[model samples]
Target: MFQGRLVQGYDFVDGDTDPSEVGAPYVNPAYGHGTHVSGIIALVAPEARIMPIRVLDENGEGDFWRIAEAIVWAANHGADVVNISFGYPQQTQLLRDLLDACSDGTTTTGKTFPEIGINRLFFSIAAGNSGDSTFIYPAADADDSNGSLAIGASTRFDRLAQFSTFHNRVKLVAPGENIVSAIPGDRYAFWSGTSMAAPIVSAVAALVKARYPNLNPVEIAERVEQTSVRISYGNPQIRINRVDALCAVTLIPPATCNP
Candidate 1:
């Protein structure tokens, strides 16, 4: 469990940094999931500050109310970029409205997300590792023309990973297969999933935001997507923009991202 760090959790998490470590007779299986995602973000953007907000237990089950609460907290607490490497297949209106608030500055009902010193937040969401063209909530919002970036897993060869969900909902792809990042017990591990691809895009959004401070949250996300390397393997119409940090920061045109 990651102790001595800024961690806030729901009631189900108790006081333990990792909810998986709280129960006595049983520990949550994904003990280092949060740290692992945070490590990827840190690895990509070392200077960016991160706030670890726990909304789900180790079993990957979460309440949409709590998740919405956490998103509101981060938006008001100086967090301009949020990386959610988790999602469910079920679609709900609660998260859909909240995700819109992150980029629209207000909800459809006119409720505000209350930003700190920058534009509304940007969300990097996992496109699920189901290996099929299935829909994952929140990330499924990628098709809604918002600041949320739905990222899928890609192999080292830049080809879509077998386990990655490729479809119109997936807006981008990144290195998710055999990804190495920090795990629990002060160690590291190699894991592969669309979950691993999301944070990489989050950090790239941070870099782009840092490079162009004036860009809005939607604009920052757009810049990254606009400069990504198109794999040319996905559908001819549905773009599968692969995230490129250097190209995003340099504002390289997507047309010139040829290998």
Candidate 2:
């Protein structure tokens, strides 16, 4: 379930590995964040194909360049939706340029939409785990910059994670805490953080795209955001509903009666 392996770039400042040979298999022993996130996405979009692009390594770390390259690769390949659950603490020019390229349909690998179709390439990123109101890199990055979706994590109760970053850049929140999903080597586990929450929304985006391929990424993102089921906290426990997602995809219209 892992994102495959780190192919190049990431190296610990203390390690002896060369940047040229940074790619590493994402097997167990190391924390399997990608595995859990990938499973959540697969669960929501059972019909969609997943491209396991490795950007992180065994140390639970990676190179900004490698991540940027992975984004470009996903766009160039036949990836209908690209889910990036990881991000760096600081923004680099190269990273920003890469994200911009992905959103604007320009990249080293190739353009996403022109080669595919308008709005065909969708970029969904985690809002980051930092507990702050300020926006974080990549997620806070302008939408038109690459026409992407920036997602924050919420509890199963639909309350924003105290640690989840809140900003104008945050479009929506989804289940992230204690989310259950697959691990490396045919295992499963539960993990917390916005990292896990992003894919749920991403998978929903994919479902909408798959069912209605004519809709562009911007259209789909707008639909999901505008249709989110907002539940208030402090009084009672709030939560997200599958029906909310169904409604976002327009499968179930608002105010519909249940049999």
Choose the strongest candidate by lDDT: 1
Report every candidate's CA lDDT.
Answer: 0.77, 0.65
As for candidate 1, its clashing pairs are 20-28
Candidate 2: worst-modelled 10 consecutive residues by lDDT: 5-14
**Candidate achieving the largest TM-score:** 1
Model 1 lDDT per residue over 98-153, tens place: 77767775666665545333347888999998899989888888633567888999
**Each candidate structure's count of clashing pairs:** 1, 4
| lDDT computed for candidate 2 | 0.65
The deviation in Å at residue 3 for candidate 1 is 12
User: Which 10 consecutive positions of candidate 1 have the poorest summed lDDT?
Assistant: 17-26
Deviation in angstroms for 258 in model 1? 4.8
Candidate 2: regions farther than 4 A off: 1-30, 104-120, 142-145, 233-243, 251-259
Per-prediction TM-score to the true structure, in the order listed = 0.86, 0.75
Tens-place lDDT digits, model 2, residues 1-259: 3243322322233333443223244453336676677788888877667666655665667777566665655656656677778776676766555555544456555533343222246777888888776667768773633557677778766577788876667767788789899865688887888888889888888888878887666666666665676655453543332225677766664445122
RMSD of 2: 6.6
